[model samples]
Structures are given as C-alpha cells and as structure tokens.
Target: MPIVSTSTSAFYERARASMKDLRSQAETLQAQLGSGEKLTRASDDPVAAARLRTLSRLESLSSIDTTNADRANADLSLADSAISNMATTIIRAQELATQAASSTLTDQQRAGIGAELDQIHDDLISLANSRDSNGHALFGGESAGNAYSVDASGNAVYIGTNSTGDLPIGDGQTVARSITGPQIFSFTDASGNTTDVMATVKALSDALKGGSTDPAGAAADALESLKQGIDTLTTGQTVVGTRLAWLDVVSERRSTLTELRTTEEASLGGTDIASTVAQLQQTLTVLEASQASFTKLSGLSLFDNLR
Candidate 1:
C-alpha cells in the first residue's frame, strides 16, 4: 500500500469549530435568561427593532398631545368661569340701574347705587385681566400682560390684541383657548348705539356725584344699557359652555385613540417569554454536551494510544 499519512488536523479543526459555535450559542442563551428577553440588540432582529422604534416615537408624540390637551382644557375652563362671573355682575348692575331709574328715588339713593356700580365695574375689569396657569392674561387675546388699563380720565382701555390664540389638539386640529374682554364686553348695538360697560358705569357715577336733580332720565337710559350688556354677556357664557363641551368630546376621543395605539405597539414589539425560555434551556444542554465531547477528544490523541 501507499505510504499512510498520520495527519489528523482536519478532525481537530472541525471539532474546535463546533466547540466555538456551541460556546457562542450558550453565551447568547445565558444573556437571554438573565435579561428575560430574546433579542439583545437590534442586529438580532432588525424588523422587530424598527417596529419598536416606531411605536416608541408614537408614544412620545401621544404624551405631548396629552399635555397640550390638558392646557387647552384648563384655558377653556377658566374662560367659562370668567364669563359666568361677568354675567352675575352684569345682572347685579341691571338691578341697581333699575332701582336708580325710579323717579321716586332721591339723588342720595342714586349716588349710593352709583358707588356700588363703580365697585362692580372695577371687579369686572379685574376679571378681564385675570391670569391663567402660565401667569398670562386669560382674556388678553395674544397679549401676555394685562388686558385692560385705565386712562387718565379713569376710562377702561383695551391694551390686548384682537386675536385669541389657538391651541393644537392634534390631528391637524386646533381650538381657540380664550376670548378677549373686548369681544365679550364691548360692542355697538343694532340701533347704531356704541357703548362699553365700564364707560356706562363711569357716566352714571359722574351724573350721580354731580347731584343732578334730573337723574331719573339718565338712570333710565343706563337701565336699558345694562340690559343690553347682560344679554351680550349671557351670549358669551353660552359660547364658552359650548366650547367646554366640545373639549370634553375631543378629550374622550383622544383617550380612546391612545389606548389603541398602546395595544398596537405591544403587538408589534412585545417578546414571547415562554418560547425564549425554552430555547435557552435547549442551548444550555447542547453546550454542555459539546464541552464534554471536546474534553474527551482533547485527552485522547494518537500519541497517547502509542504510549
């Protein structure tokens, strides 16, 4: 026979490669067991990783939207409360004006009513300049500071902008978060009548203090003006109530959408714990068997047999 070659390196190399592969699998399984997860890195499953990333981004956006909705809701609630208070104040003023309009009332009685009306006017002005959670004027439109200011003659002057800022509620939608004082309290009547409530109060106060004996006619006119003002404020309150109800509806819808998004995210990226645990156990068994076989082969070389 031809000369027999005693080289068994191929067998040793193949055995070493098998051992290396087994060790790598065992290490991966150990990591999975420790972390209670199947994938240690994105490279392990790129498709799942990408889906998880998308879900995470969407969750972040949802959180931001929720915050915006909360702010918008707060603004609307403030507006509602303000309007309600203003309506009550207007009604009180109407009552006072009616009392002053009676011909039987003396100048002294009208003066008392005028003083009270002045106080109510001041209260209304304070409400118009009320601040929100952000310390910005609630009825100031887009202006952050005080909405109404007093002139040299003690007349109420509007210092705010004309446009109410809109707050985004997501899905390409936005809501007007506030109404300006001018929008609610200042207007000209259908009969070409121009008046501001504060101005009316000032005029009544001047007439009363002047001790005019002919106060009944002026007071009568003020009573009609007070009625018109009350009607205007009531309309504003109605608008605010409608806006609050609409916000509630949108909030509920957003909550439902958020729940759906959470479920979708879980389905796309969540791990299967039972399957991952079973795979880890199998890998451990294979690794142990491979190590035992490698040890036996390492101890038994052809040279040992010769000995």
Candidate 2:
C-alpha cells in the first residue's frame, strides 16, 4: 500500500487564498453600493462605458438644438406681431385714401388729409426699420442695422440682403428665421411696373400735397397699389405661420427623442439598488462564514494532538 501525504504549509496556503478571494469579493460589492454605479471604471464594463459616452455626447448636442429652436420661435413670433401691426397701418392708409377721393371735400380738407397721409408714410418707414431681439434689423435679412434708410429725396430705400438666412433646429432640419424687407413691402403693380408699399404711399402723399394736377386721381390710383401691398403682407404672414407650425412639430419630436435617450442612459449605467443590496448581503454572509472557518482551521495543530 502507498500512502499519499499532504503538507501543512500547502493546506495553509490554500485556505488563505480562499479567504482572501472572499474578502476581495465583499469589498468590491461594498464599493459598488457606495458608488451607486455598476461600473467602477471603464475596464469593469467596457461596452457599457463606451455606450454611455456616446449617449452623453448626444445629450449635449440635443441641448444645443433646444436652444436654437427656442430662439427661432421667439424671432418668428415677433415678426408675426410686427406684420399684423403693419397690416393695420396699411388699412388706415386705405381709409385716408378713400376720404381724399371724395369730390365733395374742399381743397383745404384734402390738404389736411394729405398731412395725415404724410404722417402715415413716416410711420410705415419706422415699421419697416423695426429691430429684432438682437437689436438688428427684423426684416433686413441678417443686416446689422436698419432694413430701410431715407435717401436724399426722403425716399425709404431697401438696404438689406435678400435672404433671411436659415437656423438649424435639429434632426437635420433648418428654418428661415425672418423675412426680408423687400419680401414684405415690394410687389408687381397693375401697370406691369415694380413698386413697393413705401413708394406707393410716398407718391400719394406728394400728390395730395400739391405735387399733382389732380389729387383725387392720384389717390384713386394708389388704392389699387395699396391693396396689392396688403396682399403681399398677408402672404408673408402665412409664411411665418407655417414656419412656426413646423417648429412646433420639430420641438415635439426632439422632446420625445430626449426622453428615449434618458431612459437608455439609466438602463445602461445606473445600478439596480434593490438587487445590488441583496447581492451584497449574500456575499457578506459567505465572507463571514469563511472567516470563522479559516480562524478555527489555522489555529489547529498536529503538535497539540500528539501531546
């Protein structure tokens, strides 16, 4: 018969290694509980960590999109309000024109109407040069200053760009932030001629103030042109309204996407507190039992048995 022998040193080494492993596991679970995250570092879960990084970058970009959408919404709403006021002003000008066209009125009365028309002309010029939220031209199409400027002859001339420029809202989309001065005021007249709201009003004011042989005839002619100008303004209002609707749609979509991303972030990296705590308790219980067993085994000796 052959006897197999096991060294006491080997037994101690094996027992110490097992207890060390259990202690290391208990410390790791405790760390996870303290941190409130599943991953201690990128090395702990490389795939989950990388995915979290990507989600974080996407969140930052979404925040920027939200800001841009808000700015566009504000500028467009301002443009809509200004357009409505201008339409009201034009309607008042039409009323004045109607009164001036009356033959029953004396020359003096017509002159008084002409004076009021002059004030209206000035008001239209001021409206055209209205400022935006940034103190720049609202209808100037990205101009740093006013949209219209008074010339040497007191004519309001357009000094703005033709394009209002586009703003990026998100999800591969863009919106025109504003309408240009020419877009709101300029149109084709019945005489197959190019004319604008400011020019039409200025011409009528000049005619009524003794610049024409027949003031009544001039006022009648201006009525048709003014109607055309109103049409142009109405068209601009429709465009602004459509863009605002589009912004609302995009904003809703962005909100939904943001929520989805947030949910994914929580699922990928956030720790499950209830499950983690239970796991920690089980590990601690096993570690304590191993420690007690190791203490008793390490203290036992063959020498004591021989005595």
Candidate 3:
C-alpha cells in the first residue's frame, strides 16, 4: 500500500538539487553585479552585506568632506595671492615717493617721477578690482561685481559690500574667504586723516601732473601714507596665512578619518572570491555524484525474469 517507485523518488530529488544549484549561481551573479565584485553581497552572505552597506555610506560622507576641504583651500589661496599683489604695489609706491622727496631733483625730474606714480596708481586700482578664479571680485566684500568704480571726478570709489563672506567648513567651523577693500585699503589715520589708498594714489597722480610746487614736503607726507598702507595690507596677509595653515591641518585630519572608515568598511563587507569559488565547486561535485547514484538506483530491477 506504500508508494514505492525508484524513478519517482529520483526525479523529485534531482529536481530539488537542480533548483538549489540554480539559486546558488543566481546569487553569485547578483553579488557580482551589485558590488561590482564577486561574493561581496549580503544576499551572497548576509553578515558581509550589512558590513558593506555601512562602509559605503561612510565613504560617501568622506567624499563630501573632501570636496568641502578643497573649496576652502582654493579660496584661501586666492586671498593670499591678492594680498601679495597689494604688497608689491604698496612697495612700488613707497619707492616712488622716496625718489620724489629728494631736494636735488629739479621740477622736470619731479614731473617724471609724477608720471610713473600716476601709472602705479592705475595699477593699484586694477588690483583692487581683481577677480578670483570664479570671476568674483577678490576684495569686493561678497558682491559679485567690480569692487571699485570710477566716479565723475576720476576717483576710485568702493561699490561693494562692507562684509567679507565666510565659507562654512563643516562641524560648525567657518573660514573667512576674503577681506573687504574698505577694511584692507581704506582707513582713518591717527591724525584723523581719512585716506583711501586708491583715492590717495589718484590724488598723488593729480599733484605730480600739476607740477612739483612743494615736491619735497608733498613726497615726504605721501611716503608716510604709503608706509601705513603697506603695514595694513601686511597685517591682513599674515592673518590669511595663519588661517590657511590651520586649514591644512584640518584637511589632513579629515583624510586620516576617511582612510580609517574605508578600512573598517572593507573588513565588514568584503568577501574572499577564491574561497567562495572553491566552496561552490565542491557543492557542484557533490550534487553531480548524488544525481548519478540516484540514476543507477532507479535502473535496478529486483525481478527482471519473475514473469
């Protein structure tokens, strides 16, 4: 009364084994596709999959932080370069003032010095309107346009905002990306003399062209103003350099953190392809042997000649 057919049992067992083999192959392929690697998915091995996901997220976060660091570095470099250019211009102006201050210089000689001063003034104005890598005015105080505009009387006037915008660098930290023109090159001296470097340069140019009436005294006063301007710009450059050095430290730290996170992620989610392939081969061999045995058992006849 018991169902006893060798072929039937063999067929059912073979079908089951075939299904298992197909499932294994499908899983391997899925792992390769998802992870762009073989034997690296959770579906291939749940524990490994979980670890890989965590690592992937951490890597993404690190990448974002790296982008922020790069931007900060670029901004700092631009500011530093601008400050250097300003320093050069200030030095040149000082030299010209010194030459004009010499009493031995005749009116004709003073006029020549005046012509060069005028050109230097033009250069300074151009520098003030200098643009950054992104084409934004370097000292415009966050305005996206030219920092200096020429008035009807040919005076260089500040048309930008009064504040230097700060770039956020994660973890509640921020870096000042620029210095406003008014802060760096415009000031009121100790003697209550309000002087805009650009304006002063233009005034000097006018005086020189008009003729050296009091060349020695005028040159002496201009020399002092030029010195003060240089000092102010130098201070700004020092501050920017300090901030840049600090940023370098922070950037290096972030890089270290990213490497650590990457290592941990690999440990959690990574798979050994060689080991997985070896196990798969063994499983297939066992399945093949079982099928052969089942086939032979189903072919046997207990009473072939009983009839």
Candidate 4:
C-alpha cells in the first residue's frame, strides 16, 4: 500500500487558498481607498451602477441644452442691439419726413432731403441683413445669405426663410433665437394692404427727387409709413424681451437640476473612507495571524516528516 502523504499536501493547498483570499480582500479595500470610490466595477453594486449611468446620460443632455441656450441668448442679444439702432434710424427718418412735408422747402432742399433719405434706406437695409455672432444672417431665419436684397423692381425683397429657427433650450422647451426680417420690416396698412419699410422710404425718396405734384402729400404718406414701422419694431422688441426672460428662467432651473444630479451621483458612487479604513485594518490583522499559524503548521509538518 502506498503511504498516504495527503495530510501535509492538503494542508498546504488550504493554507495557500486562505492566504490568497485574505490578500484579495485587503487589496480590494486598499484600491477603494486609493480611488475614493465604493464600486470599482458594475458587478460590485448593479443598482447603483445603473443609476450612475442614468445620471451620466442626463448630465450629458443638460450640457447640450446649456450650450444651445448660450448660443440662442447671444443671438437674441445681437438682434436686440440691431433693432434698437434701427429704431433710432427710423425716428430720424420720421423727423426728416415731418420737415419735408412743409410747403416752404424749395425743390433743391427737397432734393437734398431725398438724398439723405436714400442714405437712410441703404442703412436700414444693411441693418436688416446684418449677421449674428456666428456670421449667420440675424434676420434671415435659417438662411445663410443676406436677409434683404433688391429684386428686379428695385424694391427691397425678403430673400430669407420665414422661420426664426427655434432651438431646444432644455427638455420640452424650445425658443426662437432671433426675429425674422419680415417680422421687423414688414407691416399691414389700415387698408389691409401689406407694405415694407424699405418700400415706404424708397418711394418717399423718389417722390421728392422727381418733384411730385403733391410734395406735402408724399411726405405725409412717408410719415404714416414710418409710424407703422416704429410700431412694428416696438412689437418685435417686446417679443424678444419676453423670449429673453424665458431663457433666464430655464437656464436657472437647469443649473439647479444639474447640481442635484451631481449630489445624487456622489451619494451612490462615493467611498466611505472611515469605514473602509477600519475594514482594511481588520483584514490585515486577520491575514497576519493566519500567516503566523500557517508558518507554525508547516514547521510541525516538516518535523513530523523527519521523524
């Protein structure tokens, strides 16, 4: 019968396994301390890991919304500045119209006034076709080119799209980034006919230049058209102001929500340093004791073999 040497070999294998298990536990604890994270892998806590993933996804979405909001606000600010300048120019034109309506002005004086009116018309068209910070047409909606261009008839025509290009500022929220050219420059007269500021100004200028039979009537018509232009601009400005207020509210709410997500993510994934430290110490103590016992047991086995 072969002499059984199973006891010593079996004890050695068991001792090695025990040491490996102890070391593994200690290493895991140390890693947690080093990383300041409780769950190094998804397997550590499946529910927590899943929640973390959801939070991460939401964070990414919020970031995108923030970017959109920022760009939209910038565009809106640019629009407001441009429109304010336009209002000022239109006011000046209105004053000129009032003065030209007087019969005391000579033909040469009217001609000079018409020349100035032409300049104002050109400036107004330039304002209508202005670009935003990103160089896209501010009043052109989604069009990349100039917002207003003259057609064959010499009247300024809207060459851009009607859409103001609404952008997603946050979940379930969209806003118009800018006002379209037509919204600011076009109007309907009391007679229910559509008219544009450019046409009104240009026609007035021509009447003065060509010495219309009724210079006073021509100037009066131009003044009425300018009055309508100012009203249209005022309404557009109000709409833009309202939109800007909405953006402010939405931006604040998003910031609060992002902060909440950050807190929740930390709660689910962050490590407990004090508890982990205690656990690591306990594991080390146990491992050291086991090592000592294994050393004594191995010495006894060797001694018995010699015997």
Candidate 5:
C-alpha cells in the first residue's frame, strides 16, 4: 500500500510540473505576439538567431552604402551642371572672338570685346573653383583649397590633387565623385601647343586689345583653341554621364539585395501570429485539463475512503 501511494504522489507532482511548463510556454508565445518578433532570445532558435545577426549586420552596411552612393550621384550631377555652364561661357567667348577676327571691326570695338573676354576669363576661373555640397571645390580632388587659383602672373594654376575623389558605394565597389580641373578645361591644341581654354581666351583678349600684325590669324588660332576646349568639356561630360548611369545601376542592385535580406530575415526570425495563437490555445487547454485532474485526484483522500 505504501509503495502504491508513493508512486501515485510522484505522478501528481510530474503532472503539476507539466502544467507549470505549459503556462510558461503560453506566456512566451504571448510576448512574441506582442513584440512581432520570434526567437526573442538566442536560446529560442540558436541557428536561426546566428543567421539573423549576420543579416542584420549586412543590412546596416547596405544602408551606409546607399547613402554614400546617393551623395556621389548628387556630386556628379553638380559637376556636370558646372561643366555645362563652362561650355556655354566658352561658346560666348568664341562668338566674341569671331567678331574680333573680322578686319572691319575698329580698335574701339576690339577693345570692348577684349574687356568682355576679360570678364569671361574671370568667370571661367570662378567656375573652375566652384564648391561642392560641402563647400569644398568640386574639382579639388583631395585638396581642401580651390581646384584652380591665379598665380602672380595671373595664369590659372591647378592646385588640387590627382584622382578627384572616390567613394565606397558598396561592398568592393567605389565610384569617382568628380573630374579634375585640368581634365575639362585644359588640353593641347592642333599645333601641339599646350593651352587651356582660359589661357587661349586670355591670349586672344590681349591680342585684340593691342594692334597686332595680323588680327585675322590670331583670331583663327583662338577659334581653333576654343573648339578644342569645347571638345574637352564634352568629353568630360560624357565621362560624368557614364558614371551617373553606373550609379543608377548599382543603386538598384543594392536596393534589390536589401529587399532580399529583409525577406530572409523575416523567414528566419519573424513571427507567425496565427500559428502562435493556436499553439497558445492548445497549451492553455492542456494546462487546464491537468489542473482539473490534479484537483480531483488530490480530493480523493485515503481517510475519505475509510469513512
């Protein structure tokens, strides 16, 4: 009789412990539903939790890459706009040079054209030293100073460093944010003479100011130099356009990858509300049944049987 009673008591103790476990599990499910996240602790699903950690880190890095890519794209756009403005200014200078080339124009008219060219030269210099979003020179490269500055003799000098600027837009990927001052504004002429657009325009302006031996030849040379300058600017624009297109492609790729990561994260660590609620209901039902059975068994006392 003693042995039978001890066995019965052990069974009831196990039943009570199981009921407590069911209630704890139900509470965990409720918390999961409230938070909208499963695997709240690493112990919930160790392998899934590890994978989620990695994906979370990657998502963070991808966000930074997207921001950098956007910034680079904006900077490139600004550079392109500035280059277009420079081209327009050059076209106006060319027009003035065309009028000055004519033999019919008087000294007074030529001087007035030169004066305008002077202003244009100054304008080009200002444009070359244009600031970017951060107030640094757009074409400054790594240099903190202006991309181009006038020396004592008044010739514009390239003061910036090489390799404009490169930004890491993604994992193992980078893009140049700008072009250098010399790439767009300076080039060699048809006669193998080294000249920048500004220098050529300035030279033409000086020649037109003075009574040269042959203003016609000088004007022709200036015209050729101006054409070369336009070509240089056009080439630079093409390069910038290509980079902008590349940025677009890369941005799309990054965005798609981010979406994929989110989906994977959801599968690995997110909750299923319906499934969790059903599980909680089942656990509660079992807990209630165990409690009722335990109470009935506990009420059937040996002394009540004897009575």
Candidate 6:
C-alpha cells in the first residue's frame, strides 16, 4: 500500500484557497443585494442586457408618440370648435338673407341687412383663420399664417395647403390634424357652379348695398348657396368627429401596449428580492463557518498538538 503524506505548506494552501472562494461568493451575493440588480455588467447576461436596451429605446419612442398624439388631439378639438362657431355664424347670415329676400322691405332696410352681412362676412373670415393650440392657423392645413387672406379687392382667398398634414399617434397609425378652409366653405351649388360661403355672402352684401340691379333677386339666389355651405360644414364636422373617435381608439390601444411593455420590462430585468436574500444568507453562513474552521486549523501546529 502506498502511504499518503500531506505537507504543512500544501495543507495551508488548500485551506486558504477554499476560504478565499467562500469569501468571494459571500461578497458577490452582498453586492447583488445592495445593487438590487441581478446583473452588475452586460457580460453577466449578454442577451438579457441587449433586450433591456432595445426595450429602453422603444419606451423613449413611445413617449414621443404620446406627445404627438396629444398635440393632434388638441388641434383637432380646436378645429371642431371653430367649425361649430362658423356654422352658427353662417346660420345667422342665412336668417338675414331671408329677411333681405322680402319684397316688402325697402332698399334702406335691405342696406341695413347688408351692413350686418358685411360684419358677418368679416366674422366668418376671422373664424376661418382661427389659431390652433400652437398659435398656427387652425384651418390652414399646416400653414403658419391665416388660412384666408384678404386681397386688395377685400375678397378672401385661400393661401393654405390643400391637404392637412398627418400626425403619428402610434402603432403605425396617423391622423389628420385639421380640415382645410375650402373643405368647409366651398362646394358646388344646384346651378352646377362652384362657390364658397365667403364669396356668396360677399356678393349678397354687395348687391344689397346697391351694387346690384335687383337686391331681392340676389338675396333669393344666395339662399341655396348658403344652405349648401352649411351642409359642407356639417360634413366637415362629421369627419372631424370621426377622426377624434379614431384617436380615442388608438389611445386605448397604446395604453394597453404600454402596460404589456411594463410587465415585460419588470419580468426581464427586475431583481428577485426574496430569492437573492435567501442566497445571500446561505453564502454568509457558509463563509462564516469556513472562516472559523480555517482559523482553528491554521493555529494548530504539530508541536502544539503533541503538547
């Protein structure tokens, strides 16, 4: 049989190595507990760290999308309110036209109605050029200035884009921020002629102010155009209302997606406090026992044992 002899230096080396390993493990567990994260560096779990980074980027983009959705909602709401006011003003103008169409009314009375109609035209123009939440033209279709500009002849002309730009809400979806002025104010009449609300009102006002050979005839002719213009406004309102409803749906979907992302983020990177605490306690206990045993064995010399 071969006899096995252990050297004191080798014994000490083995005992020290074992104690060092236990101490290292205890320190690592304590660090994990302090940081409240399972990973101290990307190298700890490369795939998980990469996934966390991707999620962080998506979260940042989602914040931006939320801001854009809010702006779109605000601008659309402003457009809706302005359109409502314009409809009311046009209806009032229609009432005045009805009074002007009466043959019983004298030219003087018609002139007074024309004066009110002039003010109504101006009010309509102002409403058409209403400002949005960001102070840009509300119905200008992305134009920074007024949607309708007054020429030297005092006629309102459209100087805005034909199409309103779309804003991205989220999930590959977009919404138009507003409807253009012409969309609400211009349409084809029964006579197959294209006319706008502002122009029709201006013509009647001019005619009633003695610019026409027959004031009552002009006022009668304008009734049909005014009715059609009101219809256009109503249609525009419906479009805006539909867009607003779509925004609501998109907002709800976004909220749901955000909740899902939050849950995934927690599952992927959040620390397990209960498990970590238990591991730390077990490591500490083992480290303490190994340390005490090492100290006792280190102090036990051959001569001491013999004595």
lDDT minimum window of 10 residues, candidate 1:
264-273
Candidate 3 vs candidate 6: the lDDT winner is 6
lDDT of each: 0.78, 0.88, 0.74, 0.90, 0.88, 0.89
Worst 10 residues of 4 by lDDT: 298-307
Kindly list the per-residue Cα lDDT of model 2 for residues 1-307, writing each as its tens digit: 9998878889888888887887787788787778767777899889999999998999998999888888889888899999999999899999988988878877788888888878888998898888877788889998888899999998999999889878888878899888998888999999899989989888988888888889998899999999999999999999999999999999999999989998887788777888888987888898789888878888988888995
Q: Is 3 or 5 the stronger prediction by TM-score?
A: 5
In model 3, which runs have C-alpha deviations exceeding 4 angstroms? 1-7, 18-64, 211-213, 301-307
Q: What's the C-alpha lDDT at position 36 in model 5?
A: 82
Check candidate 3 and list the clashing pairs: none
lDDT of 1 by residue, 211-285 (tens): 456677777777767777777777777777787787788889888987887676555544456765677678778
Clashes of 6: 0
Predict model 1's lDDT versus the native: 0.78
Which ten contiguous residues of candidate 5 have the minimum total lDDT? Answer: 1-10
TM-score of 5: 0.91
lDDT of 5 by residue, 176-217 (tens): 988998889889988887779999988888888884777666
Poorest lDDT segment (10 consecutive residues) of candidate 3: 32-41
Ranking by lDDT: 4, 6, 5, 2, 1, 3
Question: Residue 181 of model 4: what lDDT?
Answer: 89
TM-score of each: 0.81, 0.87, 0.81, 0.85, 0.91, 0.87
Query: What's the CA RMSD for each of the models?
Result: 3.7, 2.8, 3.7, 3.7, 2.2, 2.7
Per-residue error at 131 for model 1, in Å?
1.2
